[model samples]
Target: MEKIILIGDSGHAKVIEDCIRSQGGSVIAKLDDRYQERFYEEHLIKGPIALIDDLLIDDVKIVISIGSNHIRKSIVERLNIADEKYATIIHNRAIVCNSVKVDYGTVIMPGVIVNADASIGCHSIINSNSVIEHDCVVENFTHISPGAILTGNVKVGQGSHVGAGATVIPGIDIGSWTTIGAGSSVISNIESNVTAVGIPAKVIKREGL
Candidate 1:
């Protein structure tokens, strides 16, 4: 079994730990800037984020268990680890089709369904029970939150967040760095760096405006 080092120690971390275990991998340690002691019922707390370099070994894989796309990207960049050293975890309970392609460092949580021809980019999160339909393209660092649904041919850009339970209709394009509010229904295209909310999703806030 491969030994993994996980970053972060919160609820999201716990879920990622379970996903790792389900895949026949063991979490040797959890590193977080906050807690100094053992993180809950899991492995020993391996001090702060600074300890990552010290703990890294030749065979040990690393994964960022944080939920925030920005923070996850930041941690990966800060560590400067090779792409091969990053672990891509998919819970055993996830239903990913044979044609789906998931890149490195991505996490497919329990109950997630990724259909045929869908491509999920590096370090993205397909959270619990989320559905990525056929031909969907989820770019790097994006988060498809728990229970979110992306219909066929939908495109979710880099660093975007589709909030929990949000639904994007077929062929909809969600731009980079955008936020789709929880439970919203997106029927049209959303531009970059904006927050879209409500039924048929409308831009409520744009970056710097």
Candidate 2:
């Protein structure tokens, strides 16, 4: 079994831990700068994020279990670990098609259905119960929150967050750093760095506006 070092100790980390276990991988240690306590009842609290610099041992993999897309991207950039050292975890319950491509540092949570020809970029999160349709492109550092549905050929840009239960119609393009609010029904293209919300999603605020 492969040994993994999980970087985060919150509720999100707990879910990632379970996904790793379900894949028959063992979590050797957990690192969190904020909470020094154990991850749960069984996993021990290893050390701080600073310890990552000293982890030069072979065969040990790392996974950023943080929920926030920005924070996860920052940590991954700071660590700069080798591509092979970063683990891509897909829960056993996920239904990923054979033609789907999941990049390194991405996590596909339980009940995720990634259809054919879908490309999920590095360090992205396909949260539990989400449905990513055929030919969809999810760029790096994006988070498709739980229960969100991306229809066929939908494009989610880098560093974006599609909130829980949101439904994006087919061929819609969501730009980078944009935030789609929970339960939104996105019909048209959403521009970069804005927050969109409504039955037919509309931009409520632009970044730094």
Candidate topping lDDT: 2
Local accuracy of candidate 1 as per-residue lDDT tens digits, 91-152 = 99999999999999998999999999999999988999999999999999999999999999
Which portions of model 2 miss their true places by more than 4 Å?
35-45
Q: Please report, as a residue range, the 10-residue window in candidate 2 with the lowest summed lDDT.
A: 36-45
TM-scores, all candidates, are 0.95, 0.95
Structure candidate 2, residue pairs in collision = none
lDDT of 2 by residue, 56-102 (tens): 47888989999888899889888887888999999999999999999
Error of 1 at 91 (Å): 0.5
**lDDT assessment of candidate 1:** 0.91
lDDT of 2: 0.92
**Whole-model Cα lDDT per candidate?**
0.91, 0.92
Q: In angstroms, give how far residue 114 of model 2 lies from its true place.
A: 0.5
